[model samples]
Target: MAGLSQIWAHIYTTTLVFFSILFLELVILVRAAAGSIHGCKNRPITTTQYLKLVEEKNPACRYKTGLRMESLECAVCLSKYEEEDEIRKLKKCNHTFHKDCLDTWLQQDWATCPLCRSMVLPEEVVVNYWRHQNYQEFDGSDEELIFLLSALHGNYIRRFL
Candidate 1:
């Protein structure tokens, strides 16, 4: 009987220790996951500051210009932009289109500009302006120039086509 009691006590103690360790590990994991989510939410805007280094006027130019140009007719549907019309301005590339037109076009998963198939950055125009102003000192390489030109070509193609 004495030996049996000792064995039973040992089993209970070992089980308690094992469960306590598991609970502690679970608590640590939950805390670690919560901390990582908080960190991601608060991640600093280092890219915004880097963009500021190449600042020019009209950071949100695409949104503004697209709204203004919305009054003009949509090249895709040949329909006028009405105040009640659902519209979507392409990010960084300030081309505006009727939401219906854009959604239908995007359903095709085409990345080129709709009109010219050229690239446009409504926001980065400010950056390009700054770069152009300082071109003599900070001119980009030939490859960079080619890339920019190609993007411009694409934008024009979408606009005209």
Candidate 2:
């Protein structure tokens, strides 16, 4: 009976993981289908908001001090991070990279970290955090946020597509 229970438990755990992955994939698919604009359209942030989010979360610096062995290299450029190099450490995945490289990647409209492919700037999450930060300047009535959001959301499509 003990061995039977163990087998059943293993099967249950495996099935649960499989279903979880399937559900997440379905969600992603539906989200993608429901969107008109490409790139980080699901939830986009402006450079200003991104900088604020970075400051509130991981905080970039002119250079990193090599506190860890893994963060010494920029994944995008495949170059070693040196003194006076601008570094931005992602808050969600904790992956560090050259600021310019990451910015270029993001400007190309990617919503994920290059290494982990994790969503870094999902709008809801950041806005919720800003709300918690007492960001009265970030509410729905703000004109700048609206303009920037429109620019990020559809300007490229209008300009290039």
Candidate 3:
């Protein structure tokens, strides 16, 4: 047992490093899952809406091509956008990318602008992210929930006071 103890003493630093790396990886995975709001939950965008989003791009949007110093490029594909190229401009963030490129990226559950990671929910996309957070199930729409909340708030305040 003395020989075994000596061996462990020599390798303990290596064992500690391995476990530290594993703990760090686990922390990273948990944080990533927490940040992934729509991951595996929201439905993909429709072709028509994707096309409409593509048309709403700011024509003056420009990016450096490294060759020309002034031009537009898709952040996802890193390809230069020509005059007739289809591009999608994300609102609120105003980041632009190739229509096809953004469509593919958006289909994946992140639902954010690839370049800016901003929330990019379209008007038609009705994702109630709070659906899973509710303690009680209600039979009405989100608008009704808002109306019911005020009454609940008054009851809570009166009871507490």
Candidate 4:
């Protein structure tokens, strides 16, 4: 009878653990789904904000000893990072690259680390990188001009069709 009680206790403990794990997993899944539906879009930050975020996200870039390491190479320029060079590091993956290089790369629709291809900004930024091109690419055209250009593209498409 004692052996049977011990077996019963073990079974009860196992079942309790299994249910706990299932509950945690369900909570996580629900949270993830909700986040996907309501996550904020990413936006372009000011130069100072960008620099601050880079420093906050990446601890490795905080120190500069005026020496270049053989292992520390900028994937964008295919060159080693000079100690004097400003470096930016991705937050999640912790991959580092030259600040200028990564800045140019992130100007594209997708803001991803060159090496890991992970997003350069955290998901919470909620900025639409794809629609946001390089600021320098804009010509300060009026809103009417933009609308006309879009209308022209549609008309051309119709003519071709």
Q: Scored by CA lDDT, what does every candidate get? A: 0.50, 0.63, 0.55, 0.58
What tens digits encode model 2's per-residue C-alpha lDDT throughout 14-86?
5654564565567657755655455453344555666565456656777746466466789999998888888
How far residue 84's Cα lies from its native spot in candidate 2, in Å, is 2.2
Q: Model 4, which residues run further than 4 Å from truth?
A: 1-70, 123-127, 132-161
Stronger candidate by TM-score (1 vs 2) = 2
Displacement of residue 103 (Cα, Å) in model 3 is 0.9
- List, residue by residue over 1-161, the lDDT tens digit for candidate 1: 99998778667655654564565567667866776787743323333443353232212222233455633776778877665666665554556676657545543423344876653323344344433334442134655444444463454323222
TM-score, one value per model = 0.30, 0.43, 0.36, 0.43
lDDT of 3 by residue, 84-134 (tens): 666666666767777678877765544677877776764335233323223
Error of 3 at 18 (Å): 55
Candidate 4, residue 147: the lDDT equals 49
Clashes of 2: 0
- Candidate 3 is scored at a TM of 0.36
Scored by lDDT, the top model is: 2
Off by over 4 Å in 3: 1-71, 122-161
For model 3, the run of ten residues with the poorest summed lDDT = 126-135
Residue clash pairs of candidate 3 = 63-71
lDDT of 4 by residue, 1-161 (tens): 99998778667655654564565567667865765786544444454564455456654443276544434788888887655677776667767778777777765425677776876666544253332324333233555444443453454322322
**Stronger candidate by lDDT (1 vs 3):** 3
